[model samples]
Target chain A: MKWYQKHRETIVQTACLLFIVLFAYAGLTKLLEGHLFYDSIRNSPILGGKAMASLASWALPLSELAVALLLIWKKTRLIGLYGAAVLMLLFTGYTLAIVFFAPYRPCSCGGVISLLSWEQHLVLNAILLLLALMAIWSSLKNKGIPWKKTPQGR
Target chain B: MKNLKLILAMLAFIFAIGLSFAFMGDTGSGAWINYNGVPTELELDPCQGNGNDCKVVFEDDPNQTEYTVYTDDTLSQTRKSNNPEPYIIP
Candidate 1:
């Protein structure tokens, strides 16, 4: 058997774990530094309006945590993968817009990730997006695992 | 074993959370400043000394725009000298 096919389940599980770690860390930090996160959104060129920034500040961290929770269980893993891909796409799009069109780019990411410049953020988001897509594809191909519980609930 | 991998993942998650807490700080905290009539975003660290000592670092190029920020108790009272050293973005 091919190496990837032989280890497909392990690979997919690892990808899920990575997503969980990333989202949980991101969500926690954003919540911890709520004022700074809100300020970043307020100063954002795309969503600079007060109301929009206010709404996004709360929505973003909650959504990230929700995605991480979804990825924790076998039944919700696919949905979580899709959620992660969508979030990554939005992040990548925002970074691309800022790099190409914004008046200036600011490092809004908290913690160690804030060290990455906008260009680096674009590359990292793109790579993560690809990883999410690949994991979803691999997961779909491996359909031997049962989705429903047996009568005995084993 | 599957359980061992799960345990390792949980441990990594815990480590990540701890690291996040350790490194968390005000990264993008700043106010918009009118530098020589140009609206510039500068990261102004809290001034511990008399307000004149606040080093205002330019968001894009810190070295080029390194200048002292003088502000009264409020940000609205902040002022910069006319024709201050022009910052060249590299």
Candidate 2:
């Protein structure tokens, strides 16, 4: 077996750690600056309107935090990976839509992520989505338990 | 070993939250209008010279007759100026 195959469990653990940090940071930043996040949502061309903005302002950040929590425990890590992958997929799709279809683009993304340009946001989201998919595949291959199998057990 | 992993993950999560809090910008500083009775979508300024930090106008306000421009310098006497002139949208 290759070094990576031998260390698959470790790699999955590390990826899960990365995602927990990313989601927790992103969520907390949005929650901390709730007013700014609300303003951003209100200003979005695609996501305008008081009702939509209000719903997203709370939902997006809370969802991220929830995903982080889910990833913290081994029993729920598989579900968390799915959530992260879905969220990233949605974000990536939104970015693409803004780039091609929107009359005017306004980024409602939170924190340091808002500083990135549309192209950079796409690249970053794509990378994150790929990582999330890989994590899910690894977890499934291990039957959702990312532990090494003993020779006798195998 | 499991406890160690959990502790490390918790520490990393806390550290990330701390860093994000430290870098968070001024909240409620940007200008925004409630899109309650807007008829048409307003244009967003291309944000010339300003790096991603700016405000946006969503729609025309039927009740608002004057637009207030807030300057950054509080010491400057013209901190809040009311411009009654109507905006010409080209």
Candidate 3:
């Protein structure tokens, strides 16, 4: 128990590790189904049209890769956490649109995870976002940084 | 704390930019069709499937060319045409 308490940071690190792994898997899957993802994005009201959708199709995968890389590096872990959280939020919004508005079901996020329904995908994103937020909060709090610190520290 | 907040804000901005670009590039739907004498190829809508089979019928001449391709499967149907004008399966 004492040993576990002493290595509590490891638990936080593990949470981050899990998030990175999940995103990396999802990111790679998206990259593989790049064309289908591009089609969905192009059809989305938020994503406007084909030309811009193509650009986004290219960027999203790279961004996911960047987030994974950042999380693995001690110097960039916080940045990665923030990036992952924001990406999840965007994905949540996109999933909501499909659940509420879109008439057709998009391709299953392929690769190792297989196919998932829109609602299931949304839930997954939400859970990941929550985990990421918790990890980021704990990391900052443990670093002796008070949540409500004054502009000029006490 | 300040740095954390700043990083979070920056991430939010990046996401917004990404989502904006995605929205700007949206294309509703599209398809392609290639009818060459024997086997016809079609780019179908993802949802238009019957169990494991995919159905494609010509919009202009439905009776002339009717096809059903299995999922992840191809269809090969021959049509007699001496001077063939590439048929477009709407």
Candidate 4:
């Protein structure tokens, strides 16, 4: 079997697993630090007005959780991957926008995500987004192909 | 494709989640509304009577006047100012 054929399944599975864990952690952080997250949203420049900011604070985490849950199931993994890509893009774009244009930066994103500098955060998000795309594309191509069995399971 | 609807629904569900999150915090933690209704914290003591510490605006009252508040200066005359307003502590 060709190298691409041999490793395609492994790559897709890893991507799915990565997204599942990433979204779950992201969601749990928001749930655990709900108050801090809300304050952060209220301080956000993107979600103008109190109402939208307030909603985003909690919505972010739950959305992450929803994405993770969807990715976990074989039947819904594609949908989950698509959602993950959208969320990642939105997050990355927000980070880039605030860093470059906003008068004041809001540190609402708590946990390890917050620890990264804006530039670093953007890069990390971009990487994840790319991974989601690769996973989705590979899965789509592998739809009708028989699984290539390797003697040593990766 | 039917799967397309599912993807769209997933995104829509998040917006609903955002609404729920917005309503979750009854009293916004670590923040208070300022004159503009922006979420901010009082970094300085409001009761200290430092004229620079706070700006109190009674929008509904007729005074419609702006003042640099100075009061509670009993201990230190250097920071105290006598204002005609009776309610303002000196």
Candidate 5:
């Protein structure tokens, strides 16, 4: 077997699990200490003291959990990867914006990653996004076709 | 999806944690007080009327063991409440 086909399942599985941990921890922290997350967002130059603060608060954790759930299923796994990449892209963009523009940026990130500086956070998000993209490409290569064309098997 | 229950479990977990924080309210007890839900300390001059009149008051302080270690796991630094509101030193 070729290198990718030999290790395709492992690679995809590892990617999914990594994202599961990432999303779960980040989402759980926001939920556990929601007030801080909410306040931090509210203090942002983009979102601060706005009516949308409450919406972002609920939507963020909920979306993270949703993407994580999608990743757990084989049929929906690709969709989950896409979801994760999109979320990470948004987060990376937000971090970059804050680093460049915001005069008083607040760290709203949860989990141990909160210990990282904003620049480090951007790099971390970028790494995750690249991993997710690699997973998507490898999965497509393993199947020999797009995911939708594959037979549904248990 | 083979594992539908796992999704439900995660949702339940999220709800449980969120509800716990919500029910606990914004502030915490002990030596520090939560300012607008954010833990903060009053850096006042405990002798002058300009701002500080009282020192760090604790529930049980016979030895005056100043508690400096805070329960701050947040990304932002500890917020300090000044006397004049937005104390800008030029």
Candidate 6:
């Protein structure tokens, strides 16, 4: 128990390192193949067609880069984690819908990450969400709560 | 100081990951097919090809050439030939 507690910091650090690495890689790939990424989103039924997809294409990569940067910053780590968690949750839902309902399989994410089956994509997002949660928890534990409850308890 | 160090380390890690991804490029594992002969049926995309009709050319040079792909308005795609003999299609 003592040893585990002592090594917890290291473990958390390693996990954060891995999470940052994975997201950065994914983000950069989307950035490079911006057009293709947009096309996938545009094709998605969840987006309700091309216009929304185009908007996502522009928004997603920038959001990803911002989240990854925040996760790496001590000051903004928790916020970044929450943001990433929400994004991953959305992605997981979308991928699962495609797997179960979509008539055709669109091109899998390109560049470094190739065409992954919907199931595989879901699993990847789940793992990322878990990692983000872990990092957020660790950050909160290390730093005291940022805000105090109101005297009247709101 | 410790927090700063941690942040720096995380940034370095992320940047490293991004660099690795950029280097990997396209893995070419998609549903691309290599046709051996003139394709009997070719799906043409107006946006990608030269208008509706396009011609692809293969050129050969005496010196061993590096692998490079070239595309122009007149030519949809071009590939360098391995053999010295030049073949042109009217």
Top candidate on TM-score is 2
The digit string of per-residue lDDT tens for model 3 on A33-146 reads: 576567556544445465777788888888887887687666788889899889888878877876787644444434433356768888887888888887777677668667
Displacement of residue A119 (Cα, Å) in model 1 is 0.4
Q: Across residues A38-67, which tens digit of lDDT does each residue of candidate 6 receive?
A: 655654444545567667777877787777
TM-scores for chain A, candidates in order? 0.90, 0.86, 0.81, 0.86, 0.87, 0.81
Better of 1 and 4 by lDDT: 1
Candidate 4 lDDT for residue B34 = 34
Model 1: colliding residue pairs: none
In model 5, the Cα lDDT at residue A70 comes to 83
- Give the distance in Å from residue B30's predicted Cα in candidate 4 to where it truly belongs: 12
Distance from true location, Cα of A21 in model 2, Å: 1.1
Off by over 4 Å in 4: A144-154, B1-90
Worst 10 residues of 1 chain A by lDDT: A145-154
Please give the CA lDDT of all the candidate structures.
Answer: 0.70, 0.67, 0.58, 0.59, 0.61, 0.56
Tell me the lDDT of candidate 1.
0.70
| Per-residue lDDT of candidate 5, residues A1-154 (tens digit) | 5877788878887787778767766676677667657656655665565456688788998898788778777788888889998999888888888778765445444446656888888888889989988888877776776745657799
- Report the error of model 6 at residue A125, Å: 1.3
Q: How many residue pairs of model 6 clash at the backbone?
A: 0
Ranking by lDDT: 1, 2, 5, 4, 3, 6
Alpha-carbon runs more than 4 Å astray in model 3? A1-8, A44-48, A149-154, B1-34, B38-45, B48-90
Least lDDT summed over 10 consecutive residues: which range in candidate 3 chain A? A105-114
DockQ of each: 0.20, 0.30, 0.06, 0.05, 0.07, 0.13
Q: Estimate, for each residue in B1-90, the C-alpha lDDT of model 1 and write its tens digit.
A: 867755655665676688679886644434344566555554422222121334444335635565444343234554432222222111
Q: How does residue B31 of candidate 5 score in lDDT? A: 23
State model 2's lDDT: 0.67
C-alpha root-mean-square deviation, each candidate:
10.3, 8.4, 11.3, 12.6, 11.4, 11.7
Clashing residue pairs, candidate 5?
A42-A48, B45-B52
lDDT value, residue A110 of candidate 6: 60
Model 2: CAPRI class: acceptable
Backbone clash pairs in model 4 (N, Cα, C under 3 Å; residues 3+ apart or in different chains), count: 0
User: What is candidate 1's CA lDDT for residue A73?
Assistant: 75
Candidate 6 regions off by >4 Å?
A1-4, A146-154, B1-4, B7-90
Q: Cα miss at B31, model 5 (Å)?
A: 11
